[model samples]
Target: MKYLIVGLGNIGAEYADTRHNIGFNVLDALAGASNIAFTTDRYGAVAELRHKGRTLVLLKPSTYMNLSGKAVRYWLDREKIERENLLVVVDDIALPFGTLRMRTRGSAGGHNGLKSICELLGTEDYARIRFGIGGDFARGQQVDYVLGQWTEEERRLLPDRLKVFGDAILSFACVGAERTMNLFNKK
Candidate 1:
């Protein structure tokens, strides 16, 4: 079986470590833990990993955040992967920081990258792992905050939180959505 694991984040150093890059960070943790390095693939940088009998194709889209659908669709089509087997990891400003949420299908909730994938795929039926970035911005500071990095205090707790998310993603690939949700929902 094949799975397309997409990490959504903007390209360039300017976007690194921003809340928007949480997806990238989660993917990074997975790569490190498994010792699978991502080399540039057809549509993005990809790493093929086999953990616990499951094969995973980790992809960090080169299309940037807004147009992530382009890379995602390309990989999905080329690999002949089903929509259900495609799991997208993206940061969510709607959920509180350090909280991770997994869903089978839902609207983008104002997430442009997810919105683009929904539009390009013509559906939101695929799975998504939403890494919470917290929403505490005043008035119209939402953009600035999402594109910014976590505070020092938040950074201190990064490892524990990211581990849970990483394990949840692995569970999603190893088990199924229901089991993954059950395992990480309380984490």
Candidate 2:
């Protein structure tokens, strides 16, 4: 089976390691663990990993966060990967830091990247892994918080959290969304 694993984040260096870029960070860890490198592609950075007869296609969209669906749709069509086999990794502000949530389907919860994906795909039925960045900012500081770099404390705890995210992604591909959720979702 083939799975399209999309990490939603902006393309620029300015966005690197920001709270909203946890998706990219998680995928980077996964790729590093497998010793796979991503190459610049038409609309994103792409990497391929093969394990136990399954092919995992890792994508980091270059279209920025709000326009991520364009890259996602393009790759899905080009790769002919089924919608059911697609998994999106994104940051979430609703949950506390270090929390991970996997859902089979859901609304975007005001996340621009996820909103774009749902708009382009016309469905929210695909699987997604939400890495909680926490809503710790004061009122009207949402954007700054999301785009800002992580605090020193958060940076210290990030590696282990990312490992959990990587494991969840692999479990999703090796098993299935429901089973993977049961195995990895924070309770």
**Best TM-score among the predictions, by candidate number:** 2
TM-scores, one per candidate: 0.97, 0.98
Prediction 1 TM-score vs. true: 0.97
- Give the per-residue Cα lDDT of candidate 1 at 183: 81
Residue 88 local lDDT, model 2: 100
Candidate 1 residue lDDT tens string, 73-145: 9999988888988899999888888898999999988898999999999998999999888998998998999
Clash count (model 2, backbone only) = 0
Clashing pairs in 2: none
Give the per-residue lDDT digits (tens) of candidate 2, residues 72-176.
999999999999999999999999998999999999999999999999999999999999999999999999999999999999999999899998898999999
Evaluate residue 120 in candidate 2 and report its C-alpha lDDT on the 0 to 100 scale: 96
Q: Model 1 misses residue 182 by how many Å?
A: 1.6
Candidate-wise lDDT, in order: 0.89, 0.94
